[model samples]
Target chain A: MSEQQTVGFTVNGERHTVSVPTRELLVHTLRERLHLTGTHIGCDSSHCGACTVDLNGRSVKSCTVLTVQAQNAEVLTVEGLAGPDGLHPLQEGFREEHGLQCGFCTPGMLVRAYRFLQENPDPDEDQIRTGMAGNLCRCTGYQNIVKAIRYAAEKQTAGSV
Target chain B: MIPPSFAYRAPASLKEALALIDESGDDAKFLAGGHSLLPMMKFRVSEPAVLIDLGGVPELQGIREAGDRIHIGPMSTENEIIGSALLQQKCPLLPEVARWIADPQVRNRGTIGGDVAHGDPANDHPAVMLALEADFVLRSSQGERVVPANEFYFGTYFTAMEANEVLAEIRVPVLGPGTGYAYKKLKRKTGDFAIAAACVLLTLDRGICKRIAITLTNVGPTPLRASAAEQALTGKAIDDAAVENAAQLAMQICDPAEDLRGDKEYKTHMAGEMVRRAIRQALERAKEAK
Candidate 1:
């Protein structure tokens, strides 16, 4: 028997309430039910971080997380990165540094980097590599991805000052 | 890609969770971080009729000192353990070993209890716990019982924990002065399980090895405490020959199953290499401890 329940959570600052099967993964809930396709599911397994999203201020693999577990959780996706004033520094950094080749891993990378920077606002090159190690990018060999995160870190620091 | 349909129960208290599991019977599974269990569910390897999530249980959280031992909640995440100042000061081995478990995302949600109770030999915590001489606190409707790490694992995917019991807390003794430790894991990548890992804890008095505990990961059906290897180093001056003797003794007990990581011969050799490196590093740290 399939058990379903009402799960209420805020996605991108907007509260959402939906009834989903208890087995439904958080990635499917966001992409299929809510139509927030920004969070991609690369490896349905937790190995690939393409489905990464910020839950309660920490980046987690949405594909591995059950939707029911997100009850009353504040989730942040790639769509939530930008503000009314302009694009988030991470988005701008990706564009400026050519961080993407196929762009499939961009959303996960940006979202993870978004939280990672908060964890370490001004990280060194080694720190950025280690911090972003969870999210995998087949293309660009991670060279540009590292550069993109570094670029965002510098921009965020300058703006804060 | 998706887990089989199952009833989900989120109990707010430990008592409620225990009762729910007891009522659900054997088909019910306790959900911790869900990193290990969820993936198995997705692949249809495990089909639980009920999932009792302990995430809401307020009792299963935090790290604190209880007398001479450190009490660690099972729900404490790897990141939380890494960021814990108390753990860093009292038992630095835990935080050091936790950083090498998985990557950032998995570590954020992965719990120490899940890693310990999962009974997967590939998991790093079992060996570290064995080396640290830690104890597991299991609770159920009947009562609570403590199981030492060395006596916990019986074989692959099997442990001393009863089906109805919940891992309430883990108790590890605070490392005394002049103690040194290292967890040397050789993996394919950041998130990969160790091919053959060695966890070493040693104390040196003057130039002689005072006490030592050596444990190996993924080299047997269960985490193996290399008592023979420890015997080679204890009460002896750790030199090049003594270190080599311990490494060979550690390799003697390895019965690793052959897979993508390596053949049995290669894994056995790597296990020795890890022991060698860990002992050298641990010795250096022991000397530095003041």
Candidate 2:
């Protein structure tokens, strides 16, 4: 009963159309079919947020979303973080603040921070912790990660002004 | 961890979705947000042959005020619920409770309807729904039916919703003046299910308790309404003794299944503790309510 459907979506401003089985997860489609392996799958259950991605302007765990359900949707991944100018502020903050140790949860962290900033540009330390609660990191104890988000928030605010 | 092979259909409208489910037979499952069902599918706990995606149904979205009540589309995500100004002002309890659910990514995709329909005691919404005394609108090919949240849940993963029915809307009465509510959840960590959570909707007339509804989450086969606890404080000027008595009454009804969270004794005690804390908070808010 595996039904294949042609799903068309825009990823990081690039249009992609692929035929995928209905049961294929969005994270799998992005990693395998599109070869954008930036999205990592930590816990196959929806608990871990390593598969976080932006779908239609909202941060969603791609592991739980079926690829076929994302037809005509706009998706943003960790690979789409940097622009032509340089690394995105979040990426820069991660580098500057030493946000990652193992680097396994960085992609998801960056993407989730990207959307979290969009939702709350001037979030406090508590807000950052709560907003980014979906994602888990076995390393760094989340101290650097929170600092990185603060760094990005300040940088973006300063740049905007 | 991949879900078994299943044909998927995304219907553009509610009518089309109902018709597709009818045609697909009983082996078909309605997919909403995919947070609850997909995880089960990954574990092979549920293996439906067909998945009817309801994401495209326009009627199953949005939150609006209708007369004295609020009509929330079943498809509205937890984030959407948290962001709704209408709900924030009219029914603050919902948005407050929604915040305590999973986390940002999970909240973005998890729908209130899905949480209620799943009928999982651990799900935060069912307890809140019972506390607020919400109503659910179930739509099927036959017609539409309205069921109150108190009567909707049967047991773990068992709901009053028929196989062919779709949760169309959730209706909750707007909280009036002097009504204070709180949903206190005790979980191990972020995105974790509650050890024992409590939802309290309290109304006070002057210094005396006018009305109150106390409900516990993840403490039983279904979300348990602490009716005895509520009755204990109904007309009293809630003091330490009343709160303690109410909490004990709430604990008496708990039958939590032991797992990683805690053993039966700890869970049941936590249920009472949560009720105690929630009631005290609700009492303070009720005094501040205007």
Candidate 3:
């Protein structure tokens, strides 16, 4: 016997209402119920950033958060990063910089970097490294990943100007 | 890993939450930021039958000033504390320590109230609160009562808070002029728990210490206040010799258990080393404080 609850939240600017078990994590809801597989779940313990998402403008590990906790909150996953016009700057940067391999952690890394760039539009290399330390990548050694974020940062800065 | 099934209640108000806690009794647990509790739940280390979610309760949120003290809402997340301009100016030490907590994602959801109430010696806030001489306001059906930070922590995963009460607010006396504070944590990695950490808060009058508080983290069953060290530094110049002696005194109170971070001896030595560093940095900051 499992208790369930109805949770209403906004995802990628669209409203979602779902009934989930009380123990259902936001990552499971996003991937299983909502069918948004872009938000991967690597470390369910929340130590790994494979489930990172923007919850009400702040990055949070979705695996560690209950689905009910997102009630009425605005959540942004990796799938929401791009626009109708084209790929988001972060997406393009990752592509241009070859920022990933195996790509298991790319979705989370991209989503996390997307929010990171928003918080710090013109971060230096060290600042970027520190800011994105939460997200882990098994491949690429983080050198190119850092460059990818920097690439997006520069492009975004230019676009804003 | 899915957590054990539990009934969830998002109470609309603090009063409702308190009432729910009372009705549920020992089977209930107040869900704060969910960072600490959820992880434990996932591990099956905790299996509360009822979780009273405080998400919708507005009364348990915010950072405000009340006369001589600053009130930090129990639901205020670590990132909120790190970003609070008032706290940054009035009590910079909190923001400084908040930055060292886990990482961006964890900080976004980890509440200071949860960190302190969890009673984990490695959580950082308990020792920091002790050094700051903060107080916690607990709410229950009976009423509310304030518990000093030093007296609140009991043992690992234990606190003075009653089962029917929720930590409503944290009351910290606003650090005034001539006060210096620092939290020196020695963690193995970026988001790892501290091997040994020291939190130092001191008030300086000219070159002499008017008051000093030294506390150690992850070196005992609970956050250990270095009373002997604090007493030694009181009314004395914060020179290298004074800091050295105080650090040694602080080391004497450590009762650390061996963990992956290090052996007991290494943790004890790191406790003293961190205290020395924290005291020196606090003194530097104190001298600059207007």
Candidate 2 off by > 4 Å = none
Error of 2 at B167 (Å): 0.9
Highest TM-score: which candidate?
1
Clashing pairs in 3: none
Residue-by-residue lDDT tens digits, candidate 3, B30-134: 998898899889888999999999978999889998898999998999999999999998888899999999999999888998998988888989998998889
Error of 2 at B155 (Å): 0.9
Error of 2 at B74 (Å): 0.5
Worst 10 residues of 1 chain A by lDDT: A41-50
In terms of lDDT, the poorest run of 10 residues in model 1 chain B is: B173-182
Model 3 segments more than 4 A misplaced: none
How far residue B104's Cα lies from its native spot in candidate 2, in Å, is: 0.4
Residue A50, candidate 1: alpha-carbon lDDT = 95
| Candidate 2: tens digits of C-alpha lDDT, residues B219-283 | 99999999999999999899999999999999999999999999999999999999999999998
Cα error, residue B37 of model 2, in Å, equals: 0.2
Model 1 whole-model lDDT (C-alpha atoms):
0.95
How far does residue A17 in candidate 1 sit from its true spot (Å)?
0.5
* Candidate 2 lDDT score at position B141: 99
Candidate-wise lDDT, in order: 0.95, 0.93, 0.92
- lDDT accuracy of residue B49 in candidate 1: 97
Checking candidate 1 for backbone clashes, the offending pairs are none
